[model samples]
Target chain A: MTAHAPERPAAGGSAPTAPAPGRAPRRRRSGAGGAALTVLTWAIGLAFVSPALWLLLTAFKQENQAATDPPTLLFQPTLDRFSAVLGADFLPYLGNSLTATVASTVLVLLLGLPAAYALSVEPVKRTQDVLFFFISTKMLPVVAVVVPIYVAAAELSVLDNVWTLVVLYTAMNLPIAVWMLRSFFLEVPVAIVEAARVEGAGLPRILWSVMLPIMAPGIAATALICMIFSWNEFFFAVNLTASQAATVPVFLTGFITSEGLFVAQLSAAAVMASLPIVVVGWIAQRQLVRGLSMGAVK
Target chain B: MSAATAPARRTAAEPGGGPAGRRGARAAERADGWRRRAPLLPALVFTLAVTQLPFLATVVYSLRSWNLLRPDSQAWVGLANYAAVLTDSQFLGAALNTIAVTASCVVASMLLGIGLALLLDRRFAGRGVVRTLIITPFLILPVATALLWKHIMLEPVFGLVNFVLSPFGAGDVDWASQYPVLSVVVALVWQWTPFMMLLVLAGLQSQGGDVLEAGQVDGASRWQMFVWITLPHLRRYIELGVLLGSIYVVNTFDTIYMLTQGGPGTASSNLPFYIYQRTFLGFDIGQSAAMGVVVVAGTIIVATLALRLIFRTFMSAQEAK
Candidate 1:
């Protein structure tokens, strides 16, 4: 399933068209040009990332220095803003966010793993139809159901509940998790499963002892992707939760009304809210492309 | 196979034979099918309950007049809300804005993404670091990204945009307030370009080196090779990127809410934000529900066509492998 495997050229294909002897001088001539292009690539990359870098810098600045004419570049960096954000009751929102994100991701894996296995490895009838059904749910706009969700939540008296978010986020991410996990399941060879079956290992035993060890990294990648989305999700969080169960994004909304008044404090809060997922995403950069495409590209 | 045969053999040995044995075997097979499907049931049932039920409720709600602010206003309206939604100037405006935002963001980000992917495809020093830097914006919280633009980067008096443009005599211009749609689009494009780039980069890396080398030997120019080979191979990846990107971007609310609040008079309100305003702010449940249904209807029409195209591409890709 890895797209990185290059196709083998035919036996006579490369032999007749071989230009290997000319390659050395061509490579030498292009060395300076390559270096120049690398520098340009580096510059563009930095420029593309500058806004996030600016946010990092602003988080360390004082209130006045954070938003100054000519955008204060040199300044005495301080930790006051972070302290201010923490002191201002930021922990509850952080706890709620962690609870929703972690709980939902775990739930998604629990439910999605078996479904993916059924669809890929053992494949009950109409496997493609089942896969399409899952992906179609993702295409259904969240706004279409928010009104009912809100009404139902109020009626059920769970409007500001963290568990409500956990459930909704599970549904939100389950489709992608299933698709991605299915792709991972497909990559596992049939021979291994047959070997386990031949050993008289039951379904549960085979999954626990043989399959999970191989699928651990894929599952971790799926979990990371789910956490990233659940952490950053604002639509449902803002509309559904109030003070009691408001997640990090909902806490950020508190700054929206106040706007330019809390520039440094806002940056500090944003940094804290985004840091965990950003670090996780950076660590799983290679898996991200696969996860984002629902493993279609890979 | 053994279980089916054993049952048949015993039944044949008994007096009441063929029909009874076939029926028993069919029943056993049905049970076996269900057993195989047991693992899929929990997810399927959960998804149906959580996702589909609310949608069903939305359709029912759209048919009735219910306003949270106006207690006792709940009554069967029979498509009045839908009619109102179709005629409402604000709804129409938001629909247009949604199209503008989704289209421009996807197109702009994809073009920029192709360029960035091409640059990263080549052997370069510190390429890993450069790729990491490029993808960081996407990893940041959307709310944070919106705030960064709204306050630090686009603020008139102390904005980074103005400061960088000061040498060109550009004054403190209120970019968010004056050009709300463009500001929102810029924020969204920044967040999405990395996604497009990653997909395109995967496509680029998956290319067979032998083919490109063959092209070089055949005296094909770089541009010719890219056009004839690279672009054709990348079509499916690009399609996937655009489809997925549009689906997410069309539901954009955080950027609108944090940056402009769809302000300067609803100039930047996409469908999701507009529906939020109607439901939460206006407390017009029936109207918003109707709008939601309309949005879904439009999405279904577009998605069905797009999904068919992508599904074929995906299946063909799978078969090719």
Candidate 2:
């Protein structure tokens, strides 16, 4: 979570430390060019982030204040909107979201880990066919499956249950998890495994005592991504659950009605609903970056 | 070197060093197979129970008329439901709308993300904080994000955007009513551009300096370098970005549904929202199921082709290496 300054080696112990001897002045010129580059980068980043900043600012204002003709930025801040959020079932919705996200993330990791290990280490017969089989499941539109899933849930009377969400979310996250963890597992050097086997460790022991530790960061990354996916998921949580098991996204909908919407209250709720994910992203942004950028790019 | 001879001496003592040793190796191979397979059971069961069975059941239900109000009356209707879905104007319109919305979002996000990535790729003050802020939209819950856009930000008169623009003589725009499709496209792009930006940035960062320097030394201008070197390297990442973005955008319900509920008279409604409205709101399960199957089939075809296209370069590059 700590933001550290990026350190480039000033003079390295390895490789040619300096650019070719006569190129110092050219490097100095490029260093000045880099200063100009920095300004351009900040401008671009700010533009990308403007919309979200607008949303955050809107959440802070009063209903009337937000819509003022000149839109006063220096108005005294109010906690009244935040108070309304607290007055509502904000804690309950937060709890529901936490339960759903944690349960789903745990299920995805537990299920995906072994499957990825199997596929990576053993190289099953017809492996490409099996890999395709799992990946292809994502092609099915949720709309197509929702009716049957809804009916089945109605039959089993688990429609509004958090556990039902856990089940669905586990399935939703497994394919990506398997793909991610398989790559991570593959990166473990074969020499280490051969050494472990020669030392008389059984397969299960080798996995638990060796592979699991090496892949811990991968597991964490996958788990964080899975948690975000589950936490932010709306369609399933909306269509499948009602009051009893409704997650925060559904709870946010309470502010919206046919008659009228309370903008401040809704904004407050939206902020609250988004708070956990924002916190998570803040804490684990590094992991999220690595996890999402798994594929070797350029 | 002397220790290596100890293994040979031990093998000589055992004297089972030919056919018997081969049989033992075969036995070990069989045992290894079971050992390797042992960890795979839970994942297979979980996937099958949660994903595979539900999907299979959806297919079955699509072919059957199972309105649980009369459990005993349910029976297979085959293509009748599919025929009904095809004939329904609402479903067809919704399908078109879905395609249009997804395509618009994919284009908008890709362009915006590429532009943003290009900008953010250089060194800058406050770059780290700026990067985090830019991705805040992606981290927000979808439903909450939609509500904020539709209500607080896009709410014609009281919305902050209009409030900010009013000083420059810009009046409030009825985002949902007058420009329904465009509104949804903007909202979708806002939510998803970070995804594209992150992937493209990853691609950009991986392009080592030597290649760009080589292009520079060859007397290439910055524009030419970007076109000839950078853009080509970004193809795979961009394709993956578009594919993943489309998959979500096509099925997106929360933002559009929350923002417009498929209105100012079905203007913003896409296939997923249409399917939900029919199945739940209109109580037309059979037709909705049929519509869903079509969506599934379409998605599968497009995804498969996109994956194949994106991987071709990667595959050939590997082979060449």
Candidate 3:
């Protein structure tokens, strides 16, 4: 096996000594040692990826093949499961999910962006206290809030309501959004804010014209993280909604009713329900760790 | 006229002496503060309304025996419900299960994550792709992970688990029925390991080149450099992983709900799942509310410690700068 480049050793290491013109770069490990590392890495990498790969394979298998006495590496693949879910009210659930995710994401960003600005840029006297408050809200497990909310919703006659989900989802995501957006906003150059101020722009104007453009990428990153989180949220979606307002996560539970029997169809629906966030997450994975870690790792 | 002129001129010449100008400045400062706060208040108020109000309600409800099922018997019970939950055998079992599951997942995921991160940090080919693949599990929806694990990965007849075991001549085992909490922990660890890996990977990459080179120049072996430098640097990352992992793991309702449904006599039910079962299924609203308070208390304890550690990490980082 040939050795391939791993990490760019550009980080936290001495630059390789300049290579003699006619000689191969000495930094390139080109012997049995390199080959062994390459094989080992592939083995580990493949092992890590096995579950997802198996999920995908199962998604494409026929029902009979899926629960066959021994799992088969090769089978006559079928799209029946995918086609079945397409017609199985997947779209409406998809719609509910999209509406809840998009609406709640917008709500979070609109509210969270300003709060983040205040916290990161022109912080108040009790900035840390305020941030801790936001984080602490998140730490309160949903179990604590769900019963009360359920009771309240029942009284308000809003049980199984999508609008309620939108509101609840917004609340669910707001704290993390504020924390993440604040961290992202802090990355904006103070010099730029000063330059705008020197040009006679006031606070609101500085935020609109100067900060937005400079921090557009950061905002996009924050928004993306928020969307992935809101999209993948399950507990609130399951607990709060009934048929009319059921989100994709709840929709997937229908498969569980049939239990282990619909292995193929279940895998297909699982893939579909997970695809949006999985793709979103993959696209935003770099910002994701930082965001989920509440910007601490960064 | 000259005396009046002298007073006015002195006030003007002092730059900020006039009460009117000082008042104007004060008003402007106040406006600035409001402007800064204007953007923040909407979110803070919204979040507080949601948490504080409902939390107040949760607290109030916990103090009463306000069960919808027994609506006619509604009465202020004053710690009776909490007393019930505290002494309930189910709550005790679930609490123990929570600790077992959370501790195992956090420790397993962090250790595995550290190993993968150290490996991926090396300068080799295909590391980027591998890193992405490693993150695949974390990216998948929690419910999907549970379903996939229960139906596909752990299915008795054909699950990947049994298939892998069969080569060693072991036949199918009803993993969930038999192992219960261990089965759930396995799935949780799979999903969470990537998150820990991401944290540790960030730590590994953040190491300063100069220090690494200096160590290498001093003929530091890989294990020595790792133990003396990398491990110490990753201390907070590991801690962050554990704390965050614990927060999420303690709330491990999704998997246990979908996978085992807290089955085999409530063997695998964590606290959140137990509370969920009580409130939604058993209709024991008062008991559930009491248990919810307990979960919140545990969460607060964990969150406070985590927040303090995270605060220190950032403080130490800024000090380093």
State the C-alpha lDDT per candidate.
0.86, 0.73, 0.79
Residue-level lDDT for B215 in candidate 2 = 83
Which has the greatest lDDT? Answer: 1
Q: The CA-based lDDT of model 3 is what?
A: 0.79
Q: Write the per-residue lDDT of candidate 3 for residues B1-321, one digit (tens) a residue.
A: 112232343345344648897997667666766766788899988888877888778888888776677778778899999889988998999999999998999999999999888777665667667777889898888889998888888877778888888989977798989998888999999999999998898787777656766777899997898899879988988887888787778777888888999988899988888888888888777778888888788777767777898677754653453
In model 2, what are the clashing residue pairs, if there are any? none
| DockQ for every prediction shown | 0.45, 0.45, 0.45
Q: Native contacts recovered by candidate 2, as a share?
A: 0.59
Cα deviation of A38, candidate 1, in Å = 1.0
Better of 2 and 3 by TM-score: 3
Residues A26-49 of candidate 2 have per-residue lDDT tens digits of 222256677777766677677666
lDDT of 1 by residue, A127-175 (tens): 7788889889988999999999999999999999999999999999999
Model 3, range A1-298, lDDT digits (tens) per residue? 0011122132322122332233223234588988797789889989977988988998998887778766777988889999999989889889988998899888988898788888877676467788878877767888888888888899999988888888888998888888777766776766787688779998779878988776665666667777777777888788878889888888878866555458889889999988888877776666677677776655
Query: After superposing candidate 2, which stretches have Cα over 4 Å from the reference?
Result: A1-40, A258-261, A293-298, B1-31, B68-73, B164-170, B310-321
Fnat for every candidate: 0.67, 0.59, 0.68
Q: Order the candidates by TM-score, highest first — what do you get?
A: 1, 3, 2
The list of candidate 1 runs beyond 4 A from truth reads: A1-29, A198-200, A258-261, B1-21
Clashing pairs in 3: A4-B125, A5-B124, A5-B125, A6-B124, A6-B125, A12-B209, A13-B209
What are the per-model numbers of colliding residue pairs?
0, 0, 7
Worst 10 residues of 2 chain A by lDDT: A5-14
